[model samples]
Target chain A: MLVRRFVRRIAQFLIVYGIGLAGLLGLKYVLALSDYVVPDISLILETAKEVIADYIPAVFSTLSVTILGQVISIILAFSVGIAGRKSSWLGSFIRVTAYNIQAYPIVALAPIIFILLGDGFISRLLIASMICYFPLLLSVLGVMAAPVRDIEHFYRATGRMTWQLEVKIRAFENLSKLTTVISGSATLAMAGTIVAEFVAANAGIGYSIRTALYQSDLAKIFVALFLIGIIISVYQGLLETVGTWIIQKTSTEASSHE
Target chain B: MNKKYALFTYILLFLPYSFLCLLIVTHSAQAKEHEIRYRLKWLFNTSVAGDIYANKAGYFAAQGLQVNIKEGSPEKNAINELELGRAEFGVASADQVIRALDKGARLVVLAQIFQVNPMQWIYRDDQPEIKTLNDLQGKTIGITFGGNDETIMRTLLTKAGIKEKEVKLSGVRFDFMPFFRRQVEVWPVYRNSQGVILQDKLTKEGEAVRFFNPAEFGVNFVANSIITSEEMLKEQPQVVEKFLTALLQGWEAAMNQENETKVLAAVKALDKNTDARIMQKQLASTRGLVLAEAEAKKIGAIDMPAWQQTEAIMLQAGQIKRAVQVEKYLQVR
Candidate 1:
């Protein structure tokens, strides 16, 4: 069984990676078809090095703020989502708030945060959290109340033999979906924070990009974009791994019950 | 007989004074309806270093325009604000103006504040291996976003005869300088600010960066343009003329010694962390750019041939898709 599992994993990895690599190569050629015009490559490289050295503290701090902010946002969203699903009043209120946040474009909130936080990290954190919070909340709440008709029957038959039955059995059942919602929102939050940071920051990847553009430094701009893309890509991979594990764990439990 | 004559004279003076007062108040009330809001390209910094001077110095008021300046997201956003009527005017580079005009936005350039592009190239002090653009062959280079900083790379690279894709492009983070220290060949910087900062820090440590100015290579382009909507131009010609005139006067006052110190003070009020000495140096650089066209008959001067030449450079370098008629965007109204 272990040998079979290993072989299957390798095959899956190879197939997915082969397709992805091909796509990346194709995209490069397409961009090259435009001749990939850039201004000040050497200058941009030097400036990027300069900004990184001077603003190392600010960059790390912004990254940490981005991670912590998503954590807080996810926790609050889950709590609110659970409560709303369980209670009618909160459901109405949460529905309204989520819709309101969704109505505004994520980037539009940057200036507001700038006014509140004076081009500070807190402002970026708040704006990013607000943008990501809505999607996470909706996903968690909707997944919790998802139409699994037999789930109620299973609970009825068990007749609350133990509180653990209610907490672990039903909640754990949707764990896969929960991680999906969380991971997606976390990635979205990262993008939102960068955009906010771009408009009102003195330091961070966003500010670096702006300075590069002003100087007509194309190399630095591309480098920044590449880094951001890598970060988001890694986050997505990790989340998908966790999601797969959760789904497998839940599936076995359901089959065992049968 | 003397008391009767004095009372008659007092009544005669009071009637004329009150009537003039009424006329002055009524005219001001009518003018108040026209508020010209401009969205600046950068934050309230030393660039618009003269705006507060313009306001407090009565430059805008003299022209019958109450101008409210706000910060913008710098590019397309500024254009959108003008289109949406959130801002009557927007500030950006001439390239952006060309792009906006192509997008079917009826905009006009009111003034050109920066005489030359401050965009430049930088290398570490005494890095012999990577001294010039030719040295960047087969090396890893850092870039922020390739699209925004359009022509600087193509101009420098093609001039040196470096083939496209010879140098590998790496992801840009705040770590540009680190890449340089760790052996990245070259970097882009603003000569006035970033270059100054690096120069100050390095020079103090007995180090300096080998720098190249894009303008020296015939890449003289304008930065920080003042632009307005065409609809506003048609409807409020008087307001536009008054605003442009006042803004020009404001620049004049800011450049003078006595008022310049005051203008610098206003810049400090907005950003407390910037050093005064640094600002002074920046002011000197700004002065040269602002006054480069001082001899011309017009205050906010536009060079058509130079613009066409820049467009041609980009075109020759295959950066721009097609030749853009530079005159369509610069309607001096």
Candidate 2:
């Protein structure tokens, strides 16, 4: 039975990859026939490889911003989520502040940040964190503040302390939801870094895109965009995998403790 | 006898008072400085040395105008800012001006700055010699696919009778690693700005760099020029004239050998990113491009033939909807 399942998995993988490869080839052929792209296959392949190789620094720049921003976001989310449940006015005020921050357009704010921080790596980090902070905070705060009525009643009837209820029951109950919100925040983090880079960056894919626009090099623009897409996809995938691992490991520990 | 003396004194006072009133009115009219915003094509650099000099040296102030120089980024469109009335004057290349005109924006060219477009391809000295356009064949040429450089390169290829398949066209970004690593043979740059900086860097690393300027091969794609909307020209022709005159004076002063130190100091004050050494070279390159040809002997001279050729090239490339009477837009002083 195990052998058969393994074979089936391999077959599925092959089929999926086969379809993807076929689609790429079709697109390449169409683009080659048109006036938009260079028609030579070997040249196109070399260009792609060179672009990817050259964009490593940009990839790292993006990742550094995303990782740092997400770390700051997680801390903010937990603090806001826990504290917000204590008082209705505090919750309302915090929510309003978050909304205001999110509402102010990044384009206007980026230049201000650049001026304040002088276009350093730290400025990019701060810009990314600002964008990532709100969504994660709001989502986590909402889930933690409003547990299901049945769960709330059960914990209260059992005479559980507020800390005990939060730590043992509510936290586990919202683990998956928390992970989902964090994953979404990662997406916003990528966008924020790029926007900040566009305003005042010495390096990164955003700078590359800006330079490409000046030269009217459509190919460079496409390459930069393609790399960005791949970076975001990899980020989302990692978030998903890490979230799944945490949930599984925590669930196992809880069951053993019970 | 006392009444006659009083009448004489009152008449003398009235005549002097009238002359004083006339003098005040004329002085105020001449002294009123029009506050106008001039949008630059890019951030503060050697590219905008003249604009900086004009602002810092009180050239605009001398002309009874208060000009605010606003820097632009990749996302900021100077022409669009002009259309929206956010700026009175702006800098744009022939490509941008053509595109704006194609979209029905009534912008006029004030003065062409660079005698030749600074856009060119830079290759290492060790690479194949590119003395002529035909030499680009069988070579890997880097282009920003939708950029003006790409348009120019494509045109060059067509003119040289070289097929696209004959050469390798690669995409490049802001990073010079691809060119350095030999993945791309020729890379694009603004000859007077980034070109000088890149060449110096490469040369320092023991790799000398040479540029493939399109003008050498007879393709003159116009670069940044002083631009303003028709509304401004029609409503405030005097202000426009004063501004242009002062700006031209600023350019002439900036290019003068005696004023190099002042010009460099003014440009450095605005742009703090570039190295002083690189900036000096860049300034020299800028002077060369801005004041190269015979027509450029008079700073800010409008080269009508170049503008016409630029428009024709754009039309041929299908970059615009129709041929614009390019001369109708140029208001040469």
Candidate 3:
């Protein structure tokens, strides 16, 4: 199942990438643009072959930060979401703060971050987390705040309901949604890391993209995009597989108890 | 009754035909203006003062051209716009031009804008003056890693017999905090625009700063130059010549010390965020970069050797796969 899921994800990404590339090539031909403007497929393939080895390490550097940031954001989002689930003043405040922070452009805040943290791994990680955190937080908050009242009523009526039990009931009931949100946030995490690198950081695929832009090599950029897309797809596929396993196992255990 | 009906029909037909003729005449008159789009390399500042001046001063109109001058950013590549049939002419740096040419872009260089490349390093006066290239040892220098500044600096270091480990290189962004905080001893800036602003800010704080120009150390990587696709030059040679003549004239007038105030006012209208004082200083610096005293008469002359040297530098730095004989593409009017 894992292998099939992973293969499916890779195939989906390849199809999307191919179509997008075809569209670009179509436009290039229609406009009769030079290779400098939009490179031909052969040039892209050649450049990809040349740059893949170097870009792999750069992509891994980006992935490491992306994974780290996503994990940090997940932990923070769940913590904040739980605290804010009660619809109390503190909860409302947290929601307002998250909305405000998300509304504020990350690029505008990047200079302050660079000033404080410098353009190192920390800055990239922080920016990535900040970008990926808010949406996750909002989703988690929505799930946690909306009660699974039908099932919770039984526990409440029996005087056996605790906060932990309430939280677990809501999370389990909305496992599909929670998993989808977590999986979706992976893309945001990767994008955030790339943006951080593009804006300031010296390392990663984003930096390589910036270099290619300076040299005006569209082929290198296309190659980088393919690698990033494939890697992120594999990651998201893994997360979904894990989520499925957990869901199945929990359902089986609950049925046995019944 | 039949005669009256026939007269009314003739009057209606005549009115429609007359209106059509008037419309055609108006359009033809407008077409005489020869509308074209000219994309600048960067934003509206002293760096593009001459371009803005040419439009504002009616130089283009005098040549029977209706030019729309567009502002450019890093993402808004003029060469791309040209290939997509959006822009007729554009200002591109030497590296950009060479890189595009190497990639099968049929572009031609019409004129060189900055006689002296404005890309230079700004350093605090407190630091030991870099009289020689060897003086750059052990200092943390800021470079936009993928930028032309990196290529130029690396060449300088190599020429000085300095290894990469001998000095620290920091990646630069839009912020100047690192340089302000003294974390970076030397920072790269365009001598006319950012250089003027940085100098002004430091001078106000009672800190003197000096610029280290690579040209003085025998590295002359060319800056922005006027470019157009080969098709435009080949098909409409007359239009190209007229455009070049008017542009060069506007640049000459804009660079003249006598016309500094007028040029500053024109630049100020487009770039209101800049301080009036800074604008004045920036224009002065631009005048120096655009035309040295000896070359004052030749504002837009294509510096062939500079172009060749720029190509050579890019090739040596591995920015280009092979040598693009840039001279063959240069159409010096």
Candidate models: Cα lDDT each: 0.64, 0.76, 0.89
Which regions of candidate 3 deviate over 4 angstroms? B1-33
User: What does the i-RMS of model 2 come to?
Assistant: 24.1
| Candidate 3: count of backbone clashes, pairs at least 3 residues apart or interchain | 0
The residue-level lDDT of candidate 3 at B263 comes to: 91
Order of candidate numbers by TM-score, starting with the best: 3, 2, 1
Candidate 1 displacement at residue A170 in angstroms:
8.1
Give per-model CA RMSD: 19.0, 19.2, 10.3
Q: Tens digit of lDDT per residue, candidate 3, span B175-255?
A: 999999999999999999899999989999999999999999989999999999999999998889989988988998898
In the range A37-86, model 2's lDDT, one tens digit per residue, is: 21133433444675777677786787788788888878987888777855
Task: Report the alpha-carbon TM-score of model 1 versus the true structure.
Answer: 0.57
lDDT of 1 by residue, B1-333 (tens): 999998897566455555654553454234234677778876666667666567767899887778887776534356656654567877877666655554345677888776666666666666665545687678665444433334666666677889878986543433344433545555666666666666666777787777665666556655667888888889987788888888888887887767667888877887677788887776666676677667774556776766666666656754444676767667653
What's the C-alpha lDDT at position B299 in model 2?
Answer: 75
User: Best DockQ goes to which candidate?
Assistant: 3
Predicted structure with the largest lDDT when compared to the true one: 3
lDDT of 1 by residue, A173-243 (tens): 67766777777776678876777677766557777667655533444565566455545555556656767
Q: How much is B27 displaced in model 2, in angstroms?
A: 31
Angstrom error of the Cα, residue B272, model 2: value is: 2.2
Best by TM-score: 3
Residue-wise C-alpha lDDT for candidate 3, range A194-242, written one tens digit per residue: 9989887889999899988887889999999999999999999988988
Q: Tell me the spans in candidate 2 whose CA falls farther than 4 Å from its real position.
A: A1-172, A175-258, B1-33, B295-297
